[model samples]
Target: MKRGIMLLVVATILWGGNYICGRYLAPALPSNLLNTVRWAISSLLLFGLLSMNHKRLPLFSQWKKFALLGFVGIFAFSTLTYLGLRSISAAQAGMISAGIPIAILLFTPLILKERVKAKAWTGAFLSIIGVVILIRGEHAANGHSSIVGEIEIVLSCIAWGIYTVLGKRFGKTMDPLTMTAGAAVYGTLFSALSCIGTVRLNMIHMTPLAWLSVLYVSTFASVGAYLAWNTGVKIVGAGRAAPYINLLPVWTVIFGILLLRETVSILSVGGGAVTILGAVLASL
Candidate 1:
C-alpha cells in the first residue's frame, strides 16, 4: 500500500511535467499530430527497451485488453485534452481536472467492483473543494470559444477515469511494464490512423527546445509515469489510488512557476496543502 501510494504520487508529478512540455508545443503543433509523434516515439522506445530485456509481449486475447486500454487511456485522453486546450482556458481546464479524482472514485466501484470507504468519499469531497479554491484566484484572463471545447474537456476527464479503473483490471493479469508498453503500441497505431489528415509530416521542422519537450513527454510522461500508475493501481486498487490525481495540479503549478515563468497566488498554496491532506486521508 505504501509503495503504491508513493508510485501514484510520482506518476502525478510526472504527469504535471508532461503538461508543461505539451503546453510548450501546443501553439506550434496540431493536437492530432502531436499525439501521433509523441506516442510513436514512446512506443518504439518501449519496444526496444523490452526487447533488450527479453520481456514478453501480451497474448492475443490480452492484445484486446491493451488496445482498449490504449483507446481510452492514451488515444482518447491525449486527443481530447489537446483538442480542448486549443480552445479552453487554462483556468477552466484546471478546474475541470478537479473532478477526475472524484469521478474515478465513483466509477471504480461500479466498473471494477472495488470497495470504497466513507473516509475515501469524504477525502475526495475535500480535495475537490480545495481544487475550486486553488484555482479561484487565477482568472481566465481572456478567452473565446464555443461549447464544443468544453464538451471535449469533459469527455477527456471521463476517459481518464475509465483508464485508471481499466488499467487496474489489466494489471491483475500482467506486469505493468508490459501493460504500459502494449498500450503504447496500440496507442501509436490508433493515433497514427487519426493523424492522416491532422498531422503534416512534410512541413515538420522542430527546434532544439521543441525536440527536448518531445523527449521528456515520450519518455517520462508516456513510459515512466504510466508504468508507475498501472503498478500503483494494481497494488492498491483504483479506489485508493485515485485521490493521488489531485497532486497533478499542485505539481503543475510548482513546476510551471519554477520552469515556465508562471505565477502562483497565496490562496493556491492553501489549496495545495488541503489537496494533499485530502489525498492522505483518502488513501489511509
Candidate 2:
C-alpha cells in the first residue's frame, strides 16, 4: 500500500511536469520532434536496463502487438500533447489531461463489457463538467488561446484511452518492461517519420533553456516515470491501485498556481473538487 501510494505520487508529479516542460520547450522544438526525441532516449535507456537483466527482446510473436501498443500509447498520445502545449500552459494541459481516468472508466464498459456502477458515470460526468468549466474559464480571458490546443489534448486523451484498454488486453501476457521498451522504440520511429517534413534538425539554434527542458523531460518524465510507475503498480493490484488518479488534478492545480503563476477561479476549484469527488465515489 505504501509503495502504491508513492508510485501514484511519483506518476502524477512526473506527468504534471511533462506538460510544463512541453510548454517551455515547444517554442524551440516542434511537438512531434520533441516527442520523438524523448521516446528515442527512453527506448535506449530501457533497452539497456532490460539487457542488463539478460532479458532478450521479446520474440516476433510478441513484437507486433507490442509495436501497436507503443504506437497508440506513446506515438499518438505524446505527439498530440506536445502539440497541444504549444498554445496552452503546462498547468492547463495537466488539468485538462486529468479527465483521462473518467475516459478509462467510460471506455472499459464499452470495450471490455465490464459493468460500471452508477456512481462511476456520475463521477465521470462531473469530471467532464469540470473540464468544460476550466476550459471556458481560461478561454474567456484570452484571445490567443488556440482552439487547436484543446483539440489536440482532447484527442490525446482519446489516444490515452485506447492505450489503457490495449494495456489491459495485452498486459496479462506481456512483460511490462519489455512492453514499455518496445513501445518506446516503435513509437519513436513512428513519431519521427510522422514529423519528417516538419521537424527541424537545427536544434542547435534553440536556447540553452529549451535544450535543458527537453533533456529533463526525456530523462525524468519519459524514462524515469515509466519505470517507476510499472514497478509501483506491480507492488499493488490494479483495482486497489486505480483511485489514486483522483489526486492528479489537485496537484496540477496546486503546481500550476505556485509555479506557473496561472490564474484559477472559484469555478475551476469547484469543478475540480466535484470531479475528484465523483471519481472517488465511482472508483469505490
Top candidate, metric TM-score: 2
Q: Which stretch of 10 consecutive residues in model 2 shows the poorest summed lDDT?
A: 233-242
> Per-prediction count of colliding residue pairs?
0, 0
Instruction: For residues 8-114, write the lDDT of model 2, one tens digit per residue.
Output: 67877787777777767876877787888788888888889898988877746677877787788899988999888888876667667767777667777776678
* Backbone clashes (count) for model 2: 0
lDDT of 1 by residue, 1-284 (tens): 89989999999888887777766776767777778888889888888878998997864668888898889888999888777766644434544565677667767888888788999889878876765565453333223443576567668878898888888876777788788888887887888898787666654657788888888888898888998898888888776776678777667666667777765556656665665567556656
TM-score of each: 0.82, 0.90
What is the total number of backbone clashes in candidate 1?
0
Evaluated with lDDT, which candidate comes out highest?
A: 1
lDDT against the true structure, each candidate: 0.75, 0.74
Angstrom error of the Cα, residue 88, model 2: value is 1.2
